[model samples]
Target: MIDLVCNVSNAVKAVDPKAKVYINIGGAVNLLYNDRLLGCIDGVLREELRSHPGPSGPEPQDPWETPAVLDTLAYSHSHGKTVLVGSRDRLKGARSLCVRAWSHGFIPVPQPAWTLGCSTPPRQFGAVAPQWLKATSKSIIRRPYTSIQYLSLFDIL
Candidate 1:
């Protein structure tokens, strides 16, 4: 997964060499926290397991351990910095971060597909040609890759 992300970042950088990229180093969120008891309970239970006699060592830590990242982004946006985030989780912190960025006048680009497209592969290479290149070149130079390419002689009443 890291390799894939690096490859994508490199590809983007190759196209635009001066692009500044910020990568998120956090993982998925199995627990959540809010301002109320429900929020505290989940994280508290996980922390408790770390000190308990468990076979699995310890539970995973929450990703939003540092609110500084959010604060920095908010600050940068307030001072006119363009921040682009590719967030994968839907935690309360993630929502709060988005709200903070918006409040500070930053344009947050959420990666909805990153959270939703769990089963799909990031990239697939065909035996003949790559799908994106094929689709794009055909659409731009030749013709659109249409349903008619597969469906033929199907005109009915």
Candidate 2:
């Protein structure tokens, strides 16, 4: 596992020095590997790939106080870790996303604008909130909650 992580990390760095990558050993992997294995993974990271900006500042937070995927991503960027909250049930996890992000050590901040797609919904058009699209450490994503469509007329969101 350590070898694979090191090789992949090295490969990503070689491709784009600024490209960020994380080795996730959570969920099922946890069922297979114990704490010691996780520690070894951390050790490999420390020895081979240095953790940067140690304790740069306080934890990140969302300005709007809503559970948005973009905010979670922002938090991940500031912390230098890949943080993801599943979106299988967007409505169910909306606010919880913010809570989870807070617990996961992510730092949310104002982000730059992004053009996710052209909804062309007129005055009602939607996209990932501008604040959520701001720049952060490059990382993988699972789309923001704000991007979910199929709104109902009575939806109060």
Candidate 3:
């Protein structure tokens, strides 16, 4: 999978170096966190993984605070990738996550409502996302790569 992602990224970059390729391995759906797998990707294909390392899981350790999560943040930042964090709404300490992310030089991007939680009472579906992105990007980021390409397909751009 790492090779595939790298190869595809290399091929695309050959054609359009300006194009950004963001990676999100979502979750392993296994009995473990698969840190080694992510480490491998970061070790060899770190440059290809952009914007952020996407976090997903309902594990005991919230994705926002886990070692894997923090490591990815540092690794991505070191590689000059914009750090975007998508915290699960079900995860505890959301406000804390936001503060920690800000302190670590991360911009909090909205997770699709489906991933956050479809059952909860929806609030501020449209207004808050753009405001949050614009405010954080302007305040913290020197060069925000939280691009509209991903959101455009979903009609959220």
Candidate 4:
């Protein structure tokens, strides 16, 4: 896994030294603790932080807030890796998203904004509340969160 991450990261960097490489390990978030893997990637995309159980009914257990995940998040921050949370469930309200982000210390990706093919800012569109400021670092959160962008692999591959 480390080799793959390093190869892809190096490939992207070779074309554009400023490129940012973010990996989506899906539910394998524990891999964030690996120093070698963390060293090669710029950030991580945590997909489907599903709040609802499913289409059928409520789940018997919810594992999103488990201590292990929380610990991994802290470790990622200490390594200077951005954690981006993504969810496709539009049923979730903006306030709920903000509360989750505030509680977990992650930047919630505005799925609606991107899904609708528009460029509405998260604050203006209500994806993020003005009062809920994002803190990239666990120790320092007074400053606003800044989005990092890099050239896509498609641009140079």
Q: Number of the top candidate by lDDT?
A: 4
lDDT of 2 by residue, 1-157 (tens): 5555556556556765755443332222221133433322211111101011236532334343333434434433443443332222223333443344345543211111012221211123222333322434443333342321211212312
Tens-digit lDDT track of model 4 for 55-81? 775332266454566577668976888
Query: Runs in model 1 with CA error above 4 Å?
Result: 1-64, 90-100, 113-157
| Overall lDDT per candidate, in order of appearance | 0.31, 0.32, 0.41, 0.58
TM-score ranking, best first: 4, 3, 2, 1
Output the TM-score of candidate 1.
0.27
Q: Tens-digit lDDT track for model 3 on 1-157?
A: 6565556556545665544555553442221134433332322111111123345533354544456655755665665555555554433534444455557765544344344432222243321333422332111123324332221112211
Candidate 2 Cα misplacement greater than 4 A, ranges: 24-82, 107-133, 136-157
Better of 2 and 4 by TM-score: 4
lDDT, candidate 3, equals: 0.41
- lDDT for residue 44 in candidate 1, whole number 0-100: 12
- Please identify model 4 stretches exceeding 4 Å from their true place: 50-61, 64-66, 102-104, 112-121, 124-157
lDDT of 1 by residue, 1-157 (tens): 4344345446545765643333332322111111221211111101111112236543333354334444544444444334444333333234443454345454333334235231222222111222421332111113332221110112100
Best by TM-score: 4
